[model samples]
Target: MEEIRKIIHIDMDAFFASVEQLDRPELRNKPIAVGGDGDRGVVAAASYEARKFGVRSAMSSKIAKKRCPQLIFVRGRHDRYKEVSKQIMNIFHEFTDLVEPLSIDEAFLDVTHNKKNLPSATLIAKEIKKRIKEVTGLTASAGISVNKFLAKIASDVNKPDGLFAIPPKDVEAFIEDLQIDKFYGVGKVTADKMHKLGIFKGKDLKKKSLLELSRLFGKHGAYYYNISRGIDERSVNPNRIRKSVGTEHTYQSDLIDTKEIKKDIQKTTQSLVRRLEKSDFKGRTITLKLKYSNFEQETRSRTLLQIIQGEEMIQKLAEDLLDQEELKTSIRLIGLTISNRINESEPMQLTIDF
Candidate 1:
């Protein structure tokens, strides 16, 4: 697999905020927040301006305002975002059919067997970035490597309209020097646990015996062990159909009241609806996800008669799902998702926002 695999990850820089700036010249070079502006609202995206003030995506709007009082909050335009996503995906198809979108702003493409027969992955990355900028008027970063893990890290190493590639020969040393927190599957919680175990960097992680790491971290421990050695066997799966699209966050405190859960569900529903609208994605199924204090996960879903949009409809459905479940524990996370099949006849539009 190593002999023929060539994976590239392309991530747009500050995607939503950049699009907002592009479509509205007045907003250019200004601090912008794309999402709800209300007290309970959370930022979906923040421009570089807002970021300088510590504003970030998923941070509460109230906190964002505290950080940057003059921040401009703009409602996200889903249709416009979907348009740009289509254009980028089309570009990926030009190189190879093995294209997997991680989200609206990022994707992985396998171009090892591209018709152009490009000799160097670096050249391919450069051409892809150029074409993306020419078509979308937005900057993107590209990372080229033999596998997904290395490619993803390489892309983030140089960002905001940059490209980087990790040759096969350099991969081992690269992984050895990488921070444990930078590993693909190591989230904040996991990173903290690693730190408690005296594992601060990849080299430290590599020192742990596989059996010992597995005993401490469960299945994920073994995964970290292999990654520390620069070994990843996952392939670039092109036919990866999105089974679901959802967003979830761990709260600083758990909530126990039914009313509070309802409010959280409503907020999550609104966010999901916005994403659905932007993607022009309508699903027959709606799902409600919950995480309890003990970290147990549960989900309830309902199949609808037709595709639906709007916060009211989604919130109502999510509420219905939640009402049917027994909440025996305090809630830590709440999420909503819409999925199933889509109507293929509706041609996805392409609009470069900024």
Candidate 2:
């Protein structure tokens, strides 16, 4: 029998927007967003006040403004965010070396056997939350459970400044009532498919057998089957892995013509290729990302037999992917990315709190 693990997931509340408010007191208790406010600008983060009006991350600045005219926009300061992140990270290290940062503002910790030798993961989460506020003057929400998946989902239950836990005894009850969309990997696309299959909640998901799920969802079928019953055995890795390299260009105006979109993709791919060469990175997969004027985004990727990093090859693949689709929508951003190693070990699950 495997020893039951204790995991905690910590996520900063409205991270970018909160940082902006911390630096500018005038922006507190008011609506704010962080990112470019130009024609090609996208909202990287939205304050709690802004979110009340349906303003959100990845929304176009123009659309955000229309939704909330008084919304304040601030440029993101990555350096300052990094400085604060380091402080919070130090606190985690003081407790355990099993910290896995999902993003700058979020991380997972396996405290089953920590340096402090604490027996209760809930206590550690509470102390960590308190320490982060005292040191960084920012609020963070924490989730504690027996595994990484449960901890991550629990953390979001109480947003902004809250702590939630899912004990082993309550795991089944917790997951059974959880909605399908609340699952870690189930996004809008997956939720719709699950809905069609009458899998709206954890209970519904559990009704599907392993073979049926595998047939419907392919490789991810097994994942759903396990999680529906609150079983996630994945370990917490401390390594901060760099998985991919990519670049995106937001046009000043929507590129309606296929010729214009192709040109933009070519330029962006060339720049990424040069960067890849400089870093001596080798990858076999190429992904194309397109963001339409309405803020809808899509990605297409292809993996080849050999590691390829040629600009023409990347450009051609991107073009081919775009060519297969009808240009019905005007595009405001074009991007290309190359994925690196396929980790046969535990693949990282990175989540961003919206």
Candidate 3:
């Protein structure tokens, strides 16, 4: 009775690593890792060659080196990556305005009312992939389905320049065969819990009633149940604004003294303020995060009536948070974030009353 929505998930294959390879022909077909080669640096992206040696993104450079001694590490160029991302997004817009970027390298497009009025979503996906390659010299994998959940899963089925589609008729069967860990939003913690309960696949997930799942996982359980049935009502939202801009760092040695903590806070605030200035952002909220040596974490935030900026304002907020927190243990990490974006829907009301 209802028309099935046409959703497409497009993901760049080894985005950052691939970009490095494309820029340097010599690095092509070689094991390349994009990240800092420093002791404290972590791998941002690993090429397919490096991945074969068990190197992965987010792994410490030390561990990655242990995994692959010959791994070629390169520093990341955020400006270059951002430039490439813009080119790819422009290509996506050629097909549909309902494009929702998940990250710099991935996006979801609802092409139900495509510009070309193509009858088959598969054709649209092929054209998009072709365009991405032609424009950016990078390959993309695409998944076409009736909703976001199914489309995202399909995109990963055949990676590194591949396309897969799930017809509406085969949705249930396709989901039943999916591994529990492979489901979207089911991280390591959730997967371990599911395994303990003897749930290993989508079929096992489907057997549990919504109420039973809710009892086990609280609110997220309902989401799991619905996804298992290939039912995701969430639309591809294009107007999603950048919610927050933040940065954090983990110390090699724990900090115990107030002076040391304040110094670290000052450094963090300086970095955050610089970023805000570069982005032309004026936000009203400042949040401070602290993690103890024992892994206990706490966060404190202050929202102001007027948009705030500069190192002084952020540093003051961080000091307030530090004062409220108990400093019984050494601090392992500290973070600062600023947000409260002004949108067109709501009028920007700037008040001097603070």
Best by lDDT: 3
Q: Candidate 2: what lDDT?
A: 0.86
- The segments of candidate 2 whose C-alpha lies over 4 angstroms from its true place after superposition are 245-286, 289-336, 340-354
Residue 16's lDDT within candidate 3 is: 85
**Number of colliding residue pairs in each model:** 5, 0, 0
For candidate 1, what is the lDDT? Answer: 0.84
lDDT tens digits by residue: candidate 2, 83-183: 88889999999899999987788899999998988899999999999999999899999999999899999999989798999999999999999999999
Candidate 1, residue 55: how far the Cα is off, in Å = 1.8
Clashing pairs for model 2 are none
Q: Write candidate 3's Cα lDDT for 96-208 as tens digits.
A: 89999887888999998999899899999999999999999999999999999999999999998999999999999999999999998887668888999989999999999
**Segments of candidate 3 deviating more than 4 angstroms:** 245-298, 302-324, 327-338, 341-354
How much does candidate 3 score in TM-score? 0.77
lDDT digits (tens) for residues 127-239 of candidate 1: 88988889999999999998898899999988778888988888888888888888887888788889999999888999999999999988887788888888888878877
Q: Which candidate is the best by TM-score?
A: 1
Q: Which stretches of candidate 1 lie over 4 Å from their true place?
A: 1-4, 249-281, 290-297, 308-312, 330-337, 344-354
Estimated TM-score for each candidate: 0.84, 0.75, 0.77
Model 1, C-alpha of 217: deviation from truth (Å): 3.5
